[model samples]
Structure formats: C-alpha cells, structure tokens
Target: MITVFAEAGYEVDRHFDDGVVMLGFDIDPTRRSQAVMEAREHRAEARSMAELLTPSSVAVIGASREWGTVGHALLEHLIDGGFTGTVYAVNPEAFELHGIISHASLTEVPEQVDLAVIAVPHEQVDAVVDDCARAGVRGLLVATAGYADDGGDGLARQRALVHKARAHGMRVVGPASLGLVNTDPAVRLNASMAPGLPERGALSLFSQSAGLGVLLYASARRRAGSACPR
Candidate 1:
C-alpha cells in the first residue's frame, strides 16, 4: 500500500494542478519492522490529537441532553465505543448532560485537557477554537459543518480559521470530513455513519466517497463470507 502511495506521490509532484500535494510515506524497511514502526509512531504522534491532548479525558464544547444533537451523539458514541477517557460536557447555563457534570468553559476544567470536540454552530466555532487553544488543547475535532462549503461569507470565515489554527499549532480535521475509525484500538473517532466495520481483522479500506466505501465494505464482507481461505 505504501509503495502504491509512493508512486502516486511522485506522479502528483509532476503537476502543480494535482489538487493536494501528496507526500510519500518514508520508512526504511531494511532495518526490519523497527523503522516502519517508528515512522508510524511519528505519524501517530503528529495525529495523536484526542488521545494526546486529553489523557483519558475529553471536553465537548457543544454538549446537550437533547437527543440526536452532535454533542449528544458524540458522548453516547464515545461511551458505547468504550472510551476510557473522562468526558467533560461544556455548556454555559447548563450544569449537566445525560447525568454527568458539565463545565461552562474549557478553562473551568480542574486539570489539563488533551482533547476538545467542537460541535457548535459555525458562528461560534472561532470562539471555541480560541478557547481550546488558550486551554492548551492538543487535539480538536470540529463536527460542525456549514463552513466554506456553503460559500460566500462562510468561506471567508473558514479561511480565517484555517490561518488561526495553523498559527496556534492546533490540529483541525474537518469542517467536512466523515471522521475516522481505527478499530485496531477499538476506537471510532468519527461521528459519521458507522459502516459496521469488522472488529478484528487485518482488513483496511479507504475511499473518497462515503457511500462507495460502505458499498465496498458490504461487498468485501460478502466475498469473505462465501469464499474459502487458502
């Protein structure tokens, strides 16, 4: 897979119009698995995010008891996913969410925080980002949509945020991402639709379209079920 990516990366470098520049994964396989492992660890470190910033802790900036809200779903899903992290639901004028204590601000949290999941409205996102950065949050996942994808004013504001986040050394994944899933650690970080991924296996799937990804997952499951293994 890495070799395929390397070829794709070189191809990307040949043209300036290739959408996003592709960076090849560089890992020395000659030193055995150690080099590969270290490379992965470094990538993991840059993306350590939620786990790195919060140390078994989480702060949801838009938490609510209301059903079906992003905040609600995130909290519920994290619990169901067996996240051992402590979750702090932050909402001013609200004391609790689903029976757990809720803080009014990230600064109110007693100890250092590692992650902040933002699901607030687009207008409130900048403030949330500023708050998280001030709180020294290591990782932030923004679940709120309606950014530049909507065009017009939204695009300008989203661009401002892109600059702000880069300045703060804070990592922001999406204003439009479907989130991510790493079942290896029993972790499902994205709040998007779960594709009913396999719990244990060496299987890995990547797709640009969410619908196609799920369809392929179903096909793979069917093939694996009916075919005989060597």
Candidate 2:
C-alpha cells in the first residue's frame, strides 16, 4: 500500500513500534475534506438501499382491482410472493382490493410507508412523487414510463423526479422501471410486474426495461433462479 501511494504522488512513510507496523500518507486538506464528503454520501446511499430492500411497510400508489392492469399485477406480486411486511393499497376510486382496505391517497394511509411503488400514469407521476416526498417516504420505485424514454420532454421530467427525491433525502429507483424483487427468505418483496418471484440465489440483476428483465429473470430461473430488483 505504501508503494502504491508513493507511485500516486503521495508522501508515504512507514513506522514501527513494539513490533507493530503502520503506514501513513501525507494527504492535503482539500482532498481529506473531499474524501469525508464522499464517505458521507456512500453511507447515505447505503441507508437508502436498506430502506428500499427491507422496508417494514410498503404502499402501492396505483394498486388496482382490475386483473390485467400493471398496478394489479404489481400488488399481486407482493402478496403472492409471501412478503411479511405490511402492505397498503392506494386507489382513489376503490375502497378495497384483494380484501385489503385501500386509501384514497398516500397521506391517507395511517402507517409510515417505508417504500412507495409509484405505478401511476406519466402525467400523474410528478404529483404522486411530490405526495410521497411530503409524506416522508424513505424510498421510491417508479414504474411509470414516458419520462426519459419519450426523448425530448421526458428527459426534463425524469431529471425533475430525481432532483425532488434527492432534495427530500429519499432514494428513487427509476422513472421507467419494470419493478423490484428480492428473493431473500427473511424479506420476500416483489414490487415489479414480473410474472413470478424467482427462487433465492446469489445472482442479482437490475435493468430499466421490463420486457428484457422479464426475459432475463425467466432464463435465470431455468438455471436455479436469481434476485432481480430494478
């Protein structure tokens, strides 16, 4: 390590005391402060990951009663996958879905939502993200498309969504994501539109395209399965 540092323009020194060895580097104050900031950001990112992967509770913003819809499939994925956490369904028009009581909005739910899955339309996405931020949702998984994929205006829309989530100290997965699935036995979470939660394995896959993700997951399952959370 001392040799590597010396090659990288750092003043490296070695010291010994009582048979103990230690290496030191002469670091500039500006670089030291920058390193501190980078460490802080990495810690924050890890916290967000923990919240997103192992939330105590979750809310599906656009959960639906209709069987063929994306919202319906996402809700079913969570329930059928044997997720142990509290699941809240949010739909303005319906009072109940799959026997669980549904709230009119994110703020209407009584419990603290650790993760919010936004499956609403592109036009309604910005408002829904704002509501989730205001309600203090720790992490977000946006399944809504049309932003960034549509080319011109979508770029700006996607940028805004990310900026808002960061401003609130929240982590956001995607503006055009398929969903997320964790096959861990302790926390079985499938917040995506994929057909089934693959069996627990060491493989972890992430992608922006739902179609390709579904294909990859199927292939992974054929070989013993994987954990894919986009």
Candidate 1, pairs of clashing residues = 53-114, 54-114
Evaluate all candidate structures by whole-model CA lDDT and list the values in order. Answer: 0.65, 0.83
Number of the top lDDT candidate: 2
Q: After superposition, which runs of candidate 1 have C-alpha atoms over 4 Å from their true positions?
A: 1-55, 185-198, 203-230
The numbered model that scores best in TM-score is 2
What candidate 2 gets wrong by more than 4 Å, as runs, is 1-43, 208-212, 225-230
Residue 63's lDDT within candidate 2 is 94
Q: List the residue pairs that clash in candidate 2.
A: none
For 41-132, candidate 2 gives per-residue lDDT tens digits of 89977776777889889899999989888889889889888888999999999999977999999989998999999889989988998899
